[model samples]
Target: MKKNVFYVLMLFFVFTACNREDMQNNPGNIEVVQKDPLTAKEINEKINETIKTKGRFSWKESSDHFIWSTIFQGNKIASIGFGSSFDRNLDSNNKAIEAEILKVIEQYEGKTERILLSSDQYLNQIDVAIEKQETVIALRKMKNIRYLEPADYRYFENEQKLGKSSSGSSGCGFESTALSASDYTTVTPNAKAPWSFTKHNIINAWSYSSGAGVTIGVIDSGVSPEQTLLGSSFNNGLSSGRTISKNGVYVDSIWPWSTGYDGPNDQCGHGTSMASAAAAPRNNQGQPVGVAYNSNLVTYRAASNVVLDGYHEQNGVKIAFTELGNNNNVKIISMSMGHIFSVGKIEDGVKYAYSKGKLIFCAGGTSTSFTNFVGVIFPAWMSETQAITGVKENTSNQKCDVCHSGAEIDFTYQMERASGNSIPVLSYYNGQTDYVGGSSVATASTAGIAALVWSKNPTWTRDQVLNKMRQSATYYPTPNSDYGYGNINVLQAVQ
Candidate 1:
């Protein structure tokens, strides 16, 4: 009888020990243990549990954005809006239910921090919490980092209308007078060609020529054949003094859009303007010039019909990659097209280019929305944090390069209105080129600078180039939402 009693006592002790361990860990009641913010470790645990329950899911984490890209079983999207959205869907499995419950608890009572957990985990946690009669989930959860949103730039529109003239005005900041075509031989301070001046005078320690020695493939509606200012140099071989393509591919393009491919023709004037800012030939006697004029260029006709709001965005990317892939000279790419509410696929394309050691400069966006005054556009939103620097003012009233300053844009450039919604083109385009402006123009200008830097070093990595640009930028005071970093200074970059 005593032996039997001792055996029962041993069983009781084991049960008590197991209970104590459970209380200590408290995995079931995650709220009791979740005292800290949802760190990556917690997020991973939730993801694992979700995968086990849902049977399959693909997930990846970006250190840059601190978000997760997840694909559920059978390629199904268990989350709504693809990424960082309020709405989400999850599998109805046990583990999924558990994960959902945990997610809800963390979101509700744990921290304001956003933790991108797998769909299954999130759903399971929610389900479990519901069963336990504990229901609380915050609808708004975002990362702790600063994000560019649509409503962020509403003040810019007001500022523009306020009639405050900024110094970075068109043809003012970091610019020389237009080159005199007749005095090509007589090199003056502003008379010297754009490339020569930048090479000898501007560039000493820094470079704005990443596209230098690179073939920048421009896929637009079409390049003008006869136009002398834009892609015409590619055909005439006058600027670089070398044939654009050895096989004559650039000289002769027979694509479906070939009929519209007027290399320098700017019918819409948008592409031509973008191109000029990107890689206009260096004028021996002109004002400050394009960021990279000596760089190789490849032109493609991707704009199908503007009236129908149709653009060959996918085709443009495909052609750029296909043609530029094998070419050793293709180092940087600049794009000025995008739409809001996109799925960020274009950013994926940019990342692919970056992985290949190619630098990409994309436009931020413009305020075309008839409703909201402030908003963000694609391509610009995809850049690394330090990619762009806002133009600012120095104490001497000159332009300074700074990051996240809103005050220095008083002198920023804007096209002068000639009449009702139209302006004159100082240079040329594929079709009746005219003047235009937008964040797209700013983005293209930066790309040109990147090309210049690339031309100088040839050995610097993409990150190194980006850092050099940021580090070299002159900061502005009273930064706001408009100018991200500060004004871009090519001379500062070179010096």
Candidate 2:
């Protein structure tokens, strides 16, 4: 018992003192982590796998496909491409590439539905029926297309690693994603602060324009339209439970009963929070205000299954972006999702969207706390997408161990010193108020600020909009891997 207690205390100290964003002072490719000492080196040596790189997702389909990632046993496949080098020219060429990908998928054989894993149904894990239907929807109900991603295996590895949580955690929980508030001061309408928030400076920029006439696309789980504070343009100007359907299949849903879907629809409540952060219009009394109050929201429900493998998740996201880019309803797109393995077509989609004058902002998923966490994730690491890290109020410019800032622990760490004292991203949760903390939340916050800047500089080219934002960053002239040209200064960017 005493030894176990000691072990727990030691772990606490290691994690508490360790910076969550720690990494080699390199600028990219965080996927190649130094192999953990606990990992069995010899166990990896015996495989003589042969794989034909025929299927796009062959890596997950069979061990034979696994051969593509490894030569004999030692060097494994690391990170994939980000849209970082993705250019306007590439964006212009995206449509053709998308057409090719769809054409390729069409050559496959069935309307088959494959179900690999499901989150405990008690949580909001999105309906498998809905997820399966989406692939059908994406393929345009091609009765003959055999683009099935239901049971592929490779995508399940990482998720399987996280199947269990150390302590009390929710279904979509990651211990690293845990919200802490030890030293935070409570925020309220009458609340005063020792210092102003870096992101909140966009409020001052609002004097110039309040993100009017801009459509911010949230490419995640669909938003809860019932949240009146969120004020979605879809349902009577309120983000609420009004479902939209086609062929009797609900594509966008805020409520499951009417939609014929079960399982917690926004299981993690992640999508709703992101949407709210980007543009929660009717800020309730004593609650936080979103960056873009007047902007409209268009949610592309991409993350249909909470516990899906990468093939399913990435394909869903790609389809979502394709639709969003094609329609051109939104000016800015915010994606707070990331993973190591990336689908090439998705990067193409991002460049294509950017070329079409859409702004893409993504979460830089690496946190310093874990020893191996470094660099950035796909999509976010892509050039067309602005990779955003977190900047806690007091921790700015210090390279603090967080989503972005380095080595300077500030109000963020302080917030977790006590309960109710937090520096979390406050947004809509299903239809209620909820808060979360992570680099993903930071991405959403950045999305809101970008809307503010885009609104003020209406008619600027996509590259021009991004450049103005880059110039307005605190680091301005110089760009650092940690802060990425420093925090987004909405006022300076607009002025």
Candidate 3:
């Protein structure tokens, strides 16, 4: 009887050890530990700490638990991307991969309903709830899984919830300031030409080409419906035979599956200024004129503000880029908005646009609430984009007080006046003008110059036009450490 009991005990121990080994290998049945949400201050501190130690911060390297704790506090949903961003042929295969991923989630969570919140139509990305860390670990090990990050993380919203006032400082404002007479000079037809036009000799370039044949796509807040200069009056005065189209892709909801798109209108004043500075008509009604006054314009309301901190903002930008990329008429694409770090979807969108032969320009960076430590922001820091920043008049090395400069900066625009003023643009309202400064206006102005170059050489490829612009810039053979190729001489470029 004792010998039989000993044999039975050994068999029980052997079975228990086998079960433990299976659990270690699979991890699908393991329970995930829940942690409390992090405060806004804590989130900022963690990001800063990562930047200090890692030289750069990426959501790809962060753990799934940390991302959930910091970003998806109330909801446990996570955004994920699979397949190569550069592979255009992976769309068909992505569906099968997505199915396999869903199966893995079902195995871990023991559920099959409502596991997928949303999936992108163009790119290989999806949004789903991740209740277990083991699911994240399994997803990471899967083939072609690019990234997993928070889809609806809004830093400024969290700050506001904490009773912090962030007005006029987050680069988001609806107030339009009155412009001074000194800010512009009266051109033909009683139009107000921005003072920076003389600094860059854009007036001379107009004699060669007014960006007549090229179309510029401005991805920003939607063009203001109140500003008639960008609407019905777009073809008045010297600017005629061109068109302006406005699009809105921004979704004003936290839900990724929401289909309601905010209409094509400038709820924020920033987009109106950017549009005016790039392609506002040179009308006879004493309104401010754009650099490429005759260039066709297509503006998109891609985000609520200049800062891209939420899922909808980033998603809208991606959609805008893809749409602009497919538009054969669009030769140049400009965006004055960006995030402090790289967002995977945005990166993929930019690459797609670039692949379609669109000359893309992005803002180097403007001063923000917590981005003082950051350099050139993404997607400006990307190689596929030409990074532009604001420089003071009469000097290429001196940047504007609110603009950022770094090695990634590819060009500079003389937008900052000596008298503490900025570039003059048509106001969001009719019959008025406002002054816009920083890298935002600079990038748009650069895009206008590119339009002029492309218009002059209509048959030239995108690289040929870019090369001509580069050869005509201040520093051509060797670029500056902080300001790449310096400022482009618009007159020389058009010639």
Candidate 4:
């Protein structure tokens, strides 16, 4: 018995020493931490110190051990309460204590070390945890975890909605096509690709003069690899080449998803169109440039389609894209498709990118789709934290303002309205055809601009780029709901 007691005491001392060392490394800095060690028996004492400390979170000892509850002030972690165990039998008040503990835990709950391993790394461990029902969600409810932001709360709501709206299927069956007139202009000698530089001034201009020697990622309906315009887009500033697409989440893997029908096969033309805007080569031998003409292109096909009313079936696409964004090399992601219903947890992907210092550009809603001016669209909506809302106009005398009418404006760009009198470019879909217009094109334009901005200031953070766009916008044009912030001037952004 005496020996056992000695063992416990030694362990207590060892634990205390470790805690002291941890404090040195991470002082929690809310208050002044003196030279004191924390013992297993004295964890309560540490909680008391936390409470009295000047930091945001405070803590105290409770009747039971091994459990802790936190207090907060206006979403800030204010204090914590510690206990011996989470077992209800051990501490009759465990139920109440657990509830309070859950709050504190949520605040600090981010990607944990246990879950940080590679996708295959600890797959079994994750599976085992899943079998035991030990979810990150449940962990979040524990007093031991960290906090959840308001954004996180919103994500949680969106996640629940996913269960109701999602059908377990990939968005396949996209009718493939070559870049036609609708996709690009004839700039080069025989360029038929939608994103040819010679035809479209802004996009084509960006190709040669913009995105030079830069790398960009397109997360959209799959793009065709062999298109003349895109063939050499990813090539090192030379005339023509290719970037190998390796499947998986790591950066080294060129492409994140499997070579779906969309892979190098932009069936819907959305992916190919966006790519053209970002980096179509100037085969015209003139200055029809892209923002990053010399830049490299990386593609990730995440969203797949299914038969859902008015839904574009892009959740899987966004999720897959998020996984790829984990790679540090993928700095910018351009998504031009999304669903109208706000998927809350979808923002989690955006948050992950934000944490990794990645910039995400997604298309705003299409005008023909809906009139509900509130609630952002997927990826764009999910990226409430870092999204650049798209605004467009056909007329030349145009300007946007997102500040005074911050409710709507994020940024604006020019759009070529489809002429009713002329034959619209034919884009076929599931045996039916409809003319695609509105925010989709606008989004493609903004994405191209973003590529240019990134190429000019490769060092800027997503926030920095966003602020520059917001502050530098010629706002006096009187912001409108449609044209949030004014037009995106690549030259101005670079300056």
Top candidate (lDDT): 3
Ranking by TM-score: 3, 2, 4, 1
Please give, for residues 153-272, the per-residue lDDT of candidate 1 as tens digits: 112223234443232221111111333343122232332232322322333322333244655655444444444555434422224652232111221222212222223233344555
Error of 3 at 413 (Å): 0.5
Q: Report the lDDT tens digits of candidate 4 across residue range 134-220.
A: 122233334432322111011111222444223222223324333324534544443233331222244433433355434567776
Where is model 3 poorest over a 10-residue stretch in terms of lDDT? 21-30
| Per-residue accuracy of model 2 over 1-495 as CA lDDT, tens digit each | 999999999999898567333321112312323232222222222211111122112323333223222311212211122212333233343344333333422333222332212221111111122221122223322222222222222333422354521212121431122233322223333211112233445546766866777778777665554444444333322223332211111133322222242222353556766765666543223234456766777776565433223334544565566566766657888887764334444655676677677888887653422212334556676767877765444444443244433221111111111232333343443233445555566677677777777788778767787788777766667666455576666788677
TM-score for each model? 0.47, 0.58, 0.91, 0.51
Top model by TM-score, which number?
3
How far residue 140's Cα lies from its native spot in candidate 3, in Å, is 1.3
The lDDT of each candidate is: 0.38, 0.46, 0.83, 0.40
Off by over 4 Å in 3: 1-40, 53-55, 86-92, 159-165
Q: Give the TM-score comparing model 1 with the true structure, all chains together.
A: 0.47
The TM-score of candidate 4 is 0.51
- Worst lDDT run of 10 residues, candidate 1, spans 68-77
**Candidate 3: clashing pairs of residues:** none
- Model 2 CA deviation exceeding 4 Å by range: 1-151, 154-200, 231-265, 283-285, 304-308, 366-374, 397-432
Cα lDDT of model 3 by residue, 195-294, tens digit? 8998888988888998897899999988889889999999878898999999999998876667778988988888899988998888689888998999
